[model samples]
Target: MVSELRIGILGAGGIAERAMVEPAHEVEGVRVVAIGARDPERARAFAERWDLPKHGDYETILSDPDIDLVYLALPPITHAEWGIRALEAGKHVLCEKPLSVNGTTASAIADAAAATGRRAFVGFHYRLHSFTRRLLDVIASGVLGDIERVDVDFSIPHFVVKPGNIRLDGDLGGGAVMDVGCYAVDLIRAAWGEPAVESATAVLSDDDPRIDLQTDAVLRLSSGAPVHVRGSFIGDDQGAMSLRIEGSEARLAATSVIVPQWGATLRVSAGDGLLLEEKAAEGDNSYARQLEHLVAVLADGSPSILDVRRGVGTMRVVDEIYRAAGLEPR
Candidate 1:
């Protein structure tokens, strides 16, 4: 039985395009029925472009009876409010990563979803990727022995190149931490359970002190394994999208953990002898995998992978990192 899942998008943006609109077309039994943006004209344009059947404002999607799932592709600051609303409206929610600007709001959304008995998921698509599972499997197999420390980073030149991008705007829940760092934080939490933010510091943009141009944070898991997470928008190289795990027995390194649809490479070594090396075939979209999970969760009553509780936990680390860095949380 192919049970259909109807999706209503609350934001007409690039992420909605990449993570939902585009993937919705490829995945079976998933339909993006409606799309809404603050700008009605933009929503209409996006609807037409994506071949969505309907378009309107956020309220319209929430009010629709047939829209069983609401995908909140809005900014971090807006996630909690609308996520709760969609949950209350009898719609499950798939919010873009970060969940919210701070842990408090994320917790509120988690509570609302719990109260409503509705599923709410955060969009950390990479967590659903095979690269992540393989990395974890390698470590769990004891090939890496006891984890000593982990290093994960995702950086780009968006700060220098993409002028006026929403991610660079502080008031709109913009910052390197809120934008890209959440993925790093989530990956760390996924690899090593919840962590305590030991210390954090960031290079704030001279123009916008509220926005971190580059963030370097250190966290300690309960197992005493240390994690170094670096997220940046201003960078010299193409990007540093990789993870390194140092253990008592060996070292595991992975590249392109973020979007393996682009490319994925892995290397395991110890004392200069490469134990293993491999590359994943390109073209598997993590977003499509995520959509399939969401659909299965709804249809078969399956457990969610990135549920609200995990989202709130990730945001707690993010907020703690902000406090440790001497900046306000979002």
Candidate 2:
């Protein structure tokens, strides 16, 4: 087992700069040793801006003997290839979400992790947040009775800001479902067990019919409960991210459930019309919690709460939804 994990970050994207790199410094027993990008000069600039010790092309960091872990913040399309490579090189990996473009690639990553005996983690940081933990606790306590239905809405105005962004590109594993619908689907799977896609439909972009701008899916959990999930890119400017759980005995609602690191409010209403609210305490950001968890898995042999296996399950649901909507998987 490893003691301290030396991390090398792949990709110099927005998430790499904002979430993973700085958060690595805050986690004890974790160090950011290098940053790599396809462009050497871009990597150098990112490293210099972050005050990191080393920067180079992707091969430079992957071949470095001292780097025990690699944080892959590249796009979804590149996750499988790089994740497999890192595991084969005897390094643990923390790959960004959606794990891959589809279930097949995700399964390959899982297989590689098993074959190499290396720990592979997916970046579903919201699963590690305090609010999500509390939400799970409340559900487990039966306060919500038998959860009958769930409704989730997570929409953002991505197309408004960057019209031709990669997120709008169908070829690069881009769309509302791949980009944001994964989170909605994950929340459902986490709250209610693995689900079967009953039916799905989507609104394709007017300019680019190949890409989905909005999607609505119905999923049936093993427990017979139904979940309704909606995601969109050309949504209201106000940004909608909320969840409601309806049960036989009570109903629970939460705001800002996605990015609860800023703040979140949970309300529990009983059959008698009484209401209660619980607010999450300020703590380490989600990325730090995620980093700490990865370190623990590397140092000891703790099982990841949101492992690649679970990611594969989620991707299967995503693929099915696209097919039902008469569109191909990204």
Predicted structure with the largest lDDT when compared to the true one: 1
Candidate 1 lDDT by residue in tens digits, 15-80: 899899888888998999999999999999999998888999999999999899999999888998
Clash totals, every prediction: 0, 0
**Candidate 2, residue 84: how far the Cα is off, in Å:** 1.0
Prediction RMSDs, each to the true structure: 1.6, 1.5
Residue pairs in collision within model 2: none
Clashing pairs in 1: none
Displacement of residue 227 (Cα, Å) in model 2 is 0.8
Q: What does candidate 2's lDDT look like per residue over 1-330, in tens digits?
A: 778889999999888966688787788988898999999999999999989999998889889999998989888899999999999998888888878899999999999999998878778898888888988888778877898998888888554636678877776788888988998888887877788988888988776787888899888888888888888887787767789989888999887777787678899998767567887678748888888888887777878876888898889889999998898877
Measured with C-alpha atoms, the lDDT of residue 235 in candidate 1 is 70
Give the runs in model 2 whose Cα sits over 4 Å from its true position. 158-161
Q: How far does residue 141 in candidate 2 sit from its true spot (Å)?
A: 1.5
